[model samples]
Target chain A: MTLKKWIKTPKGYVAIAMFAFLIIAAIGYKDSHGIKNAFTAVFAGVIVDIILNIIKRRKWTLPEGAVITGLIIALILSTATSILVVGATAVFAILSKHFLVYKKKPIFNPAAFGLLFSFLFFKTGQSWWGAFGDLSVWTILFLLVGGYMVANRIHKFPQVFSFLGTTFVMLALMGYFNIGDAVDALRPPFINGTLFFAFFMLTDPPTSPAKDKDQVIFGFLTAAAGTLVYAAFGGLIYLFIGLCLGNLYTYLKKRSVSKSMVNRKGFISTHR
Target chain B: MVKMDKKWVILCSTAVAAAYTSGFYSTETQAVKMESAQHNQISLHTKVQQSGTTGNIANYALNQQNKKAKQKYKDGTFTGSGMNRRGDIQVAVTLRKDKIVDVQISNWGMHYSESDVVDLPGQVIQRQSANVGIVSGATYSTEAFTDAVQDAINQAQNS
Candidate 1:
């Protein structure tokens, strides 16, 4: 389909609306310390999308994935980071979306993978400004609105709920144990960094499991693993690692199911 | 039919097992890198010194003299060195009394080049200012550089 056709789809509209909200929210929050950093993020997002789309040559359209991911990256990075790093991160996100997949299924959440790559290799920070900001309330509102729209489209509410609830419970227990001030630090992941990631990044359809049962398992595992990593590492990298692990499990499960089905069909045909 | 499906189940389970093993290996590899990165970014080469006194009266007099010098200079520079598996960092920091003035950092170590860490010192210096903000995406490096600079400042003050 042409880029225009793709943009006209329901998913397209959701993407556009989310991008608009990000731009507006970013501009509104510009007065906050290092608000100007959003420009670099937006710029990086756009440039990376453009380049990737050109390479793919599928009717040049704005990459909603890159835009949202870039905004999230920008929001998380400390205000002191240079714009160049933000742009590089955007490029990494898009590239991961394109490159890190097997059997036509993506192996990781593009944005999360990008952020992880930056953290591990590029030494980029993920401050998650949305987690601690003056306009945190507004940020939460934006997430809720965007999240409802995206979740409604995919009918993945169970997955979302399981992930969020499991993560909260795990962290709460960890906090109760007084493991490194876990309880005091335990807050709604939905409020800030976790919300943005869970709502947008984790919900990517291609990379995530499709079956409802599988999704429930996948989401819970993702959250549980992420919390464990956070406890061990005491940073945001654990979040991405958790998601990536979940993706790997889902991918393998899907492949196994399909392979078995293929084998069954072949055996039945040969017998008949 | 049920008997045959058992084989399929076994195959699927085997795939899962293989994938789990691969995932574990990858995670292990990534974890090593993460740990090394964190180590490379922090330093513990710190020193502390205090000025010698001629007498009680002399100590007071020296304190006054140092205070004037500090006021007039309004800035002083500090330098320190540290190493990790990745490489070594020699950090220079300039401070205006309690405020940071400027920072110059040089690194000699590791598979990663100094250019990878050059901006780190500046980030540390900038964020040290009262009006400074956190560097975008460069959090660990900033911390590493800042820690080194703090060590240097402590050394200078003691001297």
Candidate 2:
């Protein structure tokens, strides 16, 4: 698709926004390897996506989804991660996108799934450098603005707001209570990383709810589970684990809805 | 079988609360142990310094001369720990003839993979200094590792 046409789509706009983030983040990176790692991830994502599409006999299209996933993985993973590992993560993310689907939609956020995989298998570090976690706190404005634009384009404001609100509220309560390592989440890099995840990953349409009510519930569950995990385990995987749980909920909700619809159709046919 | 009903909600809440309480207690206990260890080390160092100063003039001169002849690091194995937001890293350093002969790191908490930084122990040994320059992407883990190594060096010098 042409640039003008593509810009009108949610994926295109999000991709552009992510690239903008990558630019700002790379400029602030301490060394030259930051951009190279990102490139490796993107390259792997594109190649794997195209190959999968071919195997599935789908029409050739720009791998926009894969690109976004690659960018997210690159941004969240530590810049110190080896190039091979970065590439492998992107490949795993794209593969999960193709395979881990229900009714033609991914059941989990590919980036989050792949990141958790890397963490478990490779012990990869997460610096959230793309979110400008390492940079001065003022740089968060860019993330906020970019995130707002993407969320608006996707009409996921409800999910984004609820997640962020619940997270901060939970964190504040924990801090007030002097809970286990809860105060740390309120600090610079953790806060930045949480916002980045809320705005970008939590707002994934296929894996999150569309209705405002369900969105609110989903957000609450995600934040609660994530914060609880953080409080209990105090590890780097809490956010991703929380997100995966939310995805599971969404998948189940969709399954039940479809089941009810099928039963309703059968009853209508019998009555007719 | 997961349900979004009140019963499920209550059950999950209770479980979460229990986990949080347990975690809080565990963390508190660890913090107290760390603090106590630090306090004891400080007290011991002060006592040693005070004892050295209270000796006779001739003994003090002899001790000074002996100290000047002593190596910067006593050959032995020493262990130290470094902590960061993600976790604590413990390193065991071995010194032979005032050179760092070996380093072994144990990271029970979340940190970078071994491949993330190429041969961190080798770097420490090659440089013969705890101030091995920061690895670009693994700054936190590097800092923690270097801190632990430096802590071990401090112990070696004190010994």
Candidate 3:
């Protein structure tokens, strides 16, 4: 599809917003490394996603999802990270979307899964720069407004609210009890990162729930699990782990509902 | 029976969470600021006492002698820890003949690569001082490293 037509779609609009975010974030950095890292990640994401699509469908396809994934990874990672590492992380993210599947759908957010892998293996630092975290505190207003628009447009406000609410409550409790390092998440960059993740990654339609109640549960589960991980291990990967676990819950829930539907159909047919 | 909409639930939860978090964060930050301020005042008071009156010249000479004497290490390896917002960093400093022979970073909890601050330890040994140039990309890591080295030097002086 042409760029003009694509922009009219929800996904294309989101892609354009993400690109705008990338440009804004890149300007905050001291040097050209920010743009370089973003470029490398996006380039790698596009190439790998195209290859994977060709392999799966035996035809060329424009990979919007891959581009978004790349931009996210670039934004999250430290601007000081090597270009090669950025590219490798993008490839890994795209690879997860292609390989880790359940019922022809990915069982996890590809970007989250890939970022978790990078944290474990590469020890890459995540500054969450793409959320405009490095800039002045007023930039949070931009994140909030943009995120609200996206969530509202996608009708994922419940999911975003539940996740953010649960997270803040958990952080407050942790701070009150002096439980763990999780309380540091209340600060900037981390707060911005959490907001970014909720708006962009958690609201992923296919991996999350549709119904309002289910969406609330999904958000609550994700925040609770991620907070627990932070309490235990106190690492940056907790957010990613939480999102992946929530994805697993969604997958299982979907499977059970489909199974029951099949059984009900079989029962009626047999009775007839 | 009246049923609340999902939107109400979301709005309520968000408000409560925000208020609770802000309350806790405010108290914690205030406490930290107060504690640091007191610490700074105490250090400043000590500095004023050390440089006060005609005794300043005598004190300066004595302080220099004491500093030179205290700078000498007893020749062994010591480990020290420095903690920041990110996490703790532990470093081991090896000393010989009243000079630092080697400094090794044993563990760090920062997000940036270790390679970013790898040159720091070498600089410490060359200068025989923990006040090394900060790494371009790893400001926090460098601060933590220097603090850890300073902690090790303190241990060496006490030993």
Candidate 4:
């Protein structure tokens, strides 16, 4: 697609928004490491995506999805994380798309899967420092604007609705039941970063359910699983884990109906 | 009731199992972090206090206050906890009569290099209430710290 054509695509729009988030994060954090981490992730992700595509005999392509994935990982992971871990995660994330396949496409959200793997192997902290959490309350306005645009453009409002609704409702239940001190998570960084995830990551086109009904179910289940994860285990990886499981559920649901239901081209999507 | 997808059912079941297992793990990890936080404060305050008493920083502070003034409030240390971004934060307040003589930030589970909580204890001590003072730019940690200090103060006031 031409730059003009790509700019109009849903992924293109989201990519712009994601980059805007990076700029906002850089400004809000006012730290050189976050900016460097963002570049490292983007560079690593793009390089890996190119190398993998060439090795697989695919055409040379602009790896926008990989860039988005790298940016998300950089933004979400702790800015204090070693640059080596950041670069490794971006590479692993791109590799996950190539290796962890469902009908030759990645099964989980690449960033989520990559971050989860990094967490297990590296024990790297996920500060979600991209949310500008420690900065002004005004930061939320940017998230809200970007979130609304992307969610609206993709017609994934129901998924966002269901996920946030179910997660907060579950959180409310935890509060009522006094379930293992999860209420404190409703505060700034955790809550803000989680909302950003729901709006951006959980709505990935290939992995998430398309229909409104399925999306509602998908969102609720994701939230329920995440809440369970958060309340029980207590870590920063709950959102990523929830999305990974939700993706698995969607894949299984489609596979159960018919093998032909999924599009092969969707997996090979160079733009998205 | 609508018939749910079989795959969904299985996934939900798996989620429940995962949650159950993780809950246990979280509790254990939190306990370990709490134990270590006690150790960090010891290393931190040894030179700051010059007394070399690590385990009972709050108690030692209370004793120092006792030497200078007749006991005004209940003579004991109190502890309270609240949630932070990464984990829970706990504050121990030392009291003599009605005055908050000293405060020890007992446990904070965050591994993030946060300098904000350092100012929070002093604010609570000076203000005599968790109702006052918030370190700017550290909104969530400050809120949690204030809550923890308030919890300790309330215990001291009541006792």
Candidate 5:
């Protein structure tokens, strides 16, 4: 799709909304570094995506999804991280989308995987500054408003709703029980991080299930996994890890179903 | 019928196991550090008394730590660095006799460690105590902040 037509798609709106929220946050922090990091990630992500796409398909394709992934990765990084780290992360994210395919589609959210692996590799900060948590309580308005627009456009309400509702209530329970002060995760960066993940990344079209029932299970699994990881490792990487786990579940279920069909038909590799 | 994905169950369980292991390690290390800090403080108290030192902030602070339960840092600007596995938290503090006049953190793990700094300095100045609790969810930052502050306090006490 042309850039104009592409922006009208679901991914387009999400990307633009995320970028807008980021700018608003950068302005609020009065730190140009945030904007710079985001742009660096985007530039790097787009370039890598285009380069890889050309190599694979022998035609040029705009990196719409990669752009969104880049922006999310940048926003989640510590605003103080170097541009080189941000660019490296963006490149890795695009690479995952290009090479980590299960069946002509990547099985993980590129942004989520990029952030998770980048964090594991670099051990840098994940301030999640894009949520504008440092500014003021009223700033949640930006997340709510923009997130609503994206989630509504994509029609992934079931997944988003389940993940968010379960995450909040479960985190509150963790807080009530005083698990890692997990209830604290319901505040500031964590809350914003959860909401952003729910409304944006968790709804990744290719990796997530669309069926209402599966979506609910996937969402609950993601939250359960996230809480478990957070209570254990006590870092911000839990969200991405949880989502990846959920993606693994989906990919496995699909594979298992296909395998069963192959076995019944007495044929090898029937699904493929 | 594969009612549920077996791989899903496996991955989820594995994540839980890893989380538990990490949490256990973090808590154990924290306990050790607390014990060490307390142990060091007790031993240092005895040594300072035997030395019959006058105008030593550690002695006065210990007396206060027992009496008012904590305060009386020395006057001057001192820097302290708290080390953890991930990195260190370095803080520069200015004190006026028994009161903390100012605190500016120079480096905090170079990353998410600032979560601890959000309101910690203000709290340190307000309470005038480095024994203040850490910011929830900012454990690394909190430990580093108090550790570095205590380090600086040690410098102030000795000098």
Candidate 6:
């Protein structure tokens, strides 16, 4: 289909809205830092998308989801990070969406994968930007507003809440242990970068678990894994590692379900 | 129109390549700065005399000096407290020696947990140079812990 026809679809509208909102928000805040980072992110996404499409013999067009994800990640990361790292991460994200799975199905959240890859190999650091300058009051208000909006739209309130609640309780236990003031130090993870990842990145429809029960399981497991890694390593990269594991688990479970369905259909056909 | 003129594809790719190159070069320079900072270390020592009548004052001075030195250096420190490590409060203070250094508690009870606020010592040394920051989150523990360390320093000075 032509770009015009593609833009008329529901997914297209969502993508467009996300893209426009991100750009406008970047502008509205008059955040020169965010705006500059956003530009590099979008540019990187567009470039990567075009290259991938070309390789696959498809017509090149910007994927709105990729752009929005890049913008959000940029907003959440520290300005101390160079634009080059941001752009490299965006490219990795788009490429992972296209190439990191069998057939056409994505086996990982592209943003999560890219962030983890950047953390490990690129040594890119993240700062909590969505918390509105790391101001506690602003962080809380933003979480309430942003969390509610995301929960309502995605119908994943239970998953998000359970993940946050469970993680908070676990960290509180660490605080009880006096493990480097885990509870107070842990505020940044919940309110800062990972909040955006939880509400937006991990909850991507195409990449996340489909069933409600499975999603709850996915959420808790992701949080638990993240908490464990953070406790062990004391770094920011483990959050992405946890989410990636959740994505892998979801993929495996989906494959098993498909296999079972096929077996059932074959049994009925043979019996009949 | 003739497959929408594929010429723009080449131009776009070139532009992206240029942007990537510029970004990479600039970041490589910053990465060097970060590496240098990581390896940088600072060390300083200050002496305080204790009045024979009140050794607490000298201990307080030494603790304050250590914190101030760490802050001045903007580097981490390594400090230890308590006699023979079997005390209600044994702490380690790591300092670069011009500012308040990172503080670690080697031993403390559950009651002491609240008082072991890290930022308090760091901030106190930063602001007052010789005073401790208010352990807003954990008051009693901070006082007991800071005073105990101060006492150790006073003994060192008296000796």
lDDT of every model, 2 decimals? 0.59, 0.76, 0.76, 0.72, 0.72, 0.56
Docking level of model 3: incorrect
- Residues A123-158, model 2: lDDT tens digits: 777998888877898999997888777876777766
Residue A123 displacement (Å), model 5: 0.6
The interface root mean square deviation of candidate 3 comes to 5.5
Task: Report each candidate's C-alpha RMSD, comma-separated, in the order given.
Answer: 12.2, 8.5, 6.2, 11.9, 11.8, 16.7
Point out the higher-scoring one by lDDT: 4 or 6: 4
2 or 3, greater by DockQ: 3
Query: How well is each residue in A166-190 modelled by candidate 4, as lDDT tens digits?
Result: 7766765665566755544565567
Greater-TM-score candidate between 1 and 2: 2
- lDDT (tens digit, per residue) of candidate 6 on A151-210: 545556545645655565556556555453343234433335556666666667677765
Superior by DockQ: candidate 3 or candidate 4: 3
Please say which candidate is ahead in DockQ: 1 or 3: 3
For residues A45-128, what per-residue lDDT tens digits would candidate 3 score against the true structure? 999888778778845657788888888888888787788888999999889888887777787898898888887777776878
Of the candidates shown, which would achieve the greatest TM-score relative to the real structure? 3
Tens digits of per-residue lDDT for model 1, B32-87: 56456445434222112133321122233356677864332225786755433222
Lowest-sum lDDT 10-residue window in model 4 chain A: A259-268
- For model 3 the TM-score comes to 0.80
Better of 1 and 4 by DockQ: 1
Model 6: how far residue A133 lies from native, Å: 5.0
Alpha carbon lDDT at B45, candidate 2: 43
Better of 3 and 6 by DockQ: 3
Best by DockQ: 3
lDDT of each residue in B59-124, candidate 5, tens digit only: 566687679754545578988777543345778988775657888888754325354466888877
Q: Could you arrange the candidates by DockQ from highest to lowest?
A: 3, 2, 1, 4, 5, 6
